[model samples]
Target: MGLFITFEGPEGSGKSTQARLLYERLQRLGYPVILTREPGGTRIGELIRRILVDLRHTEMAPTTETLLFSAARAQLVSELVRPYLKTGGIVLCDRYADSTFAYQGYGLGRDLEELQSITTVATGGLMPDLTFYLDLDVEMGLQRKRSARDRLPEPASAAAAFTPHPEWNRLDARDLAYHQRVATGFAELMRRDPDRWRCFVANQPVDLLAEQIFTQVEPMLARIVRLENPR
Candidate 1:
């Protein structure tokens, strides 16, 4: 069977960049690899991604957003992930169900069990064999994304009703308390699935981070090769 790998983290944690690097490295090693991202891996999913990320849709409710994300995930898995897995290819996903759990359940205060159920159905129980979670501070991630702030909402008044704040970019909109909760949620998930999840401190340089990931992945790659080429 194919090996499924996923990268998860808060915004600006470099999960996307590292996923691309790993995909390239795996291809260089002659492994059949497929690179894709959640909320976008399929045509319908890409449309959903535009709706989810567009700053103009600032009034979207938390529940609606959560369901939209799950919908996209279901389409992506059924269209892209399942076929690649069936071909014994290494599937490198930029983000997956974990994002919904972190962003919607933990950050947006949705019910965790409900979100888990949605994810289970969306993925058809096809969880990643390995997940590399890049941990970083919310402040740092916000700072990294602040440079391109043209599309984000401004910070809203704390006392007034929840108007769209320009800083309400997906990750930036959350209060520090919520972001901390997300971090704790991810940590808890790691503890709960220690065999499948690996936590990495992503406060390092890109090359160094890649090297650390390679160290963990090399053995897994060897095992994949052994299984594929049993003599």
Candidate 2:
């Protein structure tokens, strides 16, 4: 089977950057790969993303939020991710079921068991073969996010964030405690699955972190390549 990888982290933790760099590196090697993000991959997922991220949706209940994300995940796994993986194509996702565990389950104080049940229904029990978690202090990550937002041509308000990138939604505007819980939750998740989850400090230089990530990914990718075309 093709490699299924996902990146996870707090906001501004550079998950997207590392994922993109790795994707490019794989492409240069002539690997068949597809890079995608959760809550929005297919047409139905994008529409669900609009509701999940819009700042005006402050009235959104935690249950409602979880369900919306699950709905989008169901579509993505069934539509794009599953087919690609079955065909022996690498699929790197920005975020996946883990986010639901971190955000709604841990960050929002929901039941992890219940979340897992929902996630099973969403992704049809598909799990990432490798998950990279960009570790960063909650406050530092938030600061980075704020600074980056401030640098944007458009003002980095709730409205602007949601409009431009749906993932950069009202969550960024949430309370510090909420984000702290997410960071802590991530640690717990990684701890539970040391074999599958690789944690890296996010405060380091991009190239350095990418190198570290590449170090971890290289052997695995090599194995996949070797297995697919055995001598």
Candidate 3:
């Protein structure tokens, strides 16, 4: 199977940019790379994403949110991710099941054990080979999101009020304490799986951050080259 790399962080952490940079870099280096995201990878996933992020759905229960995300995840894993991995294509995902753990399990005070069980079923036990956590100050991330939304010219989506810009959603508009909890949750996750995750301060220059990521992924490229041209 191909390498699965996931980018995890709070909103405005610049993880999406970094993931895109890595995907382009890998492609330039001639690796077959696939860039995708959770809650909206496949068609079904997109529908789920709409429901999850649409600000109008403020009544969405936490349990309902979790299941919706899982439903989208199941479709992505089965429909796209699995086959692409079997073909040895590198998959760079913006968010995966870990978001559930951070947002639902940790931030919303859901049972971590239960969240893991559901996510495992949704993903069929597929795990990322490397995960990059772009640690950002919760406030800074929020500010960045606000700036981004301000800069966008054609802003308001009739589908949703909260900017899920591949960005923040209804979840992000909550108070600082809620977001802080999510950030803390991310920290805890990194602590639990130190080996699988690379921590980076996302406040740095994009080029610098991307370079650091390349250095890490460069070693993995060896595996890709070998698999592609096995002698």
Against the true structure, whose TM-score is highest?
Answer: 3
Q: Write the per-residue lDDT of candidate 1 for residues 63-142, one digit (tens) a residue.
A: 88988998998998888888877877788999898888888887888999999898898888889989999999977876
List all candidate RMSDs to the true structure.
Answer: 6.1, 3.3, 2.9
Write the residue-wise lDDT of candidate 3 on 1-231 in tens digits: 688999999988998899999988787767888899877889889988878887677899989999999999999999988898898788899999888999998899999999999999999998899999999999999999988877766655755345455555687788899899999999999999999999998989999999999898888876664335422
Clashes of 3: 1
Candidate 2 to truth, TM = 0.92
lDDT of 2 by residue, 171-197 (tens): 788899999898888889998999999
Provide the lDDT at 125 for model 2: 99
Candidate 1 stretches with Cα past 4 Å from truth are 148-168, 223-231
Candidates 1 and 2 compared by lDDT, better number: 2
Provide TM-scores for the models: 0.85, 0.92, 0.92
Sliding window of 10 residues with minimal summed lDDT for model 3: 222-231
TM-score of 1: 0.85
True-structure lDDT of candidate 2: 0.87
Model 3 residue 25 CA deviation (Å) reads 0.6
